[model samples]
Target: MATDAVKKYLEDTNRPYSCADVTVNLRGAFTKSAIQKALDALSEAGKIKCKLYGKQKVYAAIQHDNADGPSENEDYDTPIKTTTIELEELNTQLKTKEASLKSLLAAPTSDSARVQAGEIKTNIEKLESRLATLRDSVEVMSADEKRGILESHAKLLSEYKKRKRICSEMIEAMLEGYPKSKKNFLEELCIETDEMVDFKLVSFQV
Candidate 1:
């Protein structure tokens, strides 16, 4: 009976849930191990889909040929809400970093300018790391979910390109102003030159 209810819940929602999630959603209607058993049985019977997301197992209700997948009445936004939030956050951080970089570039070179440049570099590195993480997260999403996120974020993608162009220009400016040693340092960091930085890899358009 609990297994049927669990299957119904998955079918109605059309989303994946971890075992812990299933236990919480069921709210003591079934023991955690019991729910796990049901999920295993469902997977074996082709009644549900089960896969590992990282180290954790997740289950989603299987959609049959005749069954409706996502209904017209269903909330489409619910599926990619986390991705939306992440993109918004990334846009905000990118904007902040862009402003900082612009400001750093506008100021005349001084000890303070060098320190600001270092800080900007660190922030950019962190942003790149976040971008790589976002890409990985997107890869895990279903094709439709990934398409939805990319379509909704077209403007964000444009902003990224604009910012990349700005950064490239700023790097050229820095190379012109800084000594040879600074150029060597940048090369060692694999940045090499302003022209060498491949903006396409980080572009959301890609």
Candidate 2:
């Protein structure tokens, strides 16, 4: 049976062997699962000693001391303990790396961010183009044009004042013996002046 074969190998070697080591050393005499089961059974039966070195189970033959000295297996315990502690620290670091990877996976991908950046850039370019067009379309008055406009405004204002004075004088003469006051007679005639509607005539300066 494979269990007998495994047990014989352990007793003959009289040294520690992990399941993987035994599988390789056995040269395909037994499948890995069969060797593992055999190792477990032998350890449970106290036919061999099993110690866990980190995540791996190592089996050794049960040592018996001779009358001359202690068995060699007695020397393995200290090194195994040190190796276990180191493996535990490595496992902790590996777990931390895995958590970081998971968090990165949950966030937005680089491709998506690039696509959004491209859209924002396109919108900004369009707005800049529109602003440039509006600036170009606006008309700027030259100094000569501004002066001409001011002169035209002054002339029209002077003509308007002259016409208003003439009309006021004619009205006053006609209202000399009128029953109502001049202001009242003007209101009855539904006449509106610039001052009545709070209108201001402002002069332009070049």
Instruction: Estimate, for each residue in 6-95, the C-alpha lDDT of model 2 and write its tens digit.
Output: 988987887788899899999999999999999999999998889886578888887665454654445667766776788789999999
The CA root-mean-square deviation of candidate 1, after full C-alpha superposition on the true structure, stands at 34.1
The model with the greatest lDDT is 2
TM-scores of the candidates are 0.34, 0.46
C-alpha lDDT score of every prediction, in listed order? 0.77, 0.86
Clashing pairs counted in every model: 0, 0
Candidate number achieving the greatest TM-score relative to the actual structure: 2
lDDT of 1 at 198: 50
lDDT of 2: 0.86
The total number of steric clashes, by the backbone 3 Å criterion, in model 2 comes to 0
Model 1: per-residue Cα lDDT over 142-178, one tens digit each: 8788778877688677787798789778877877867
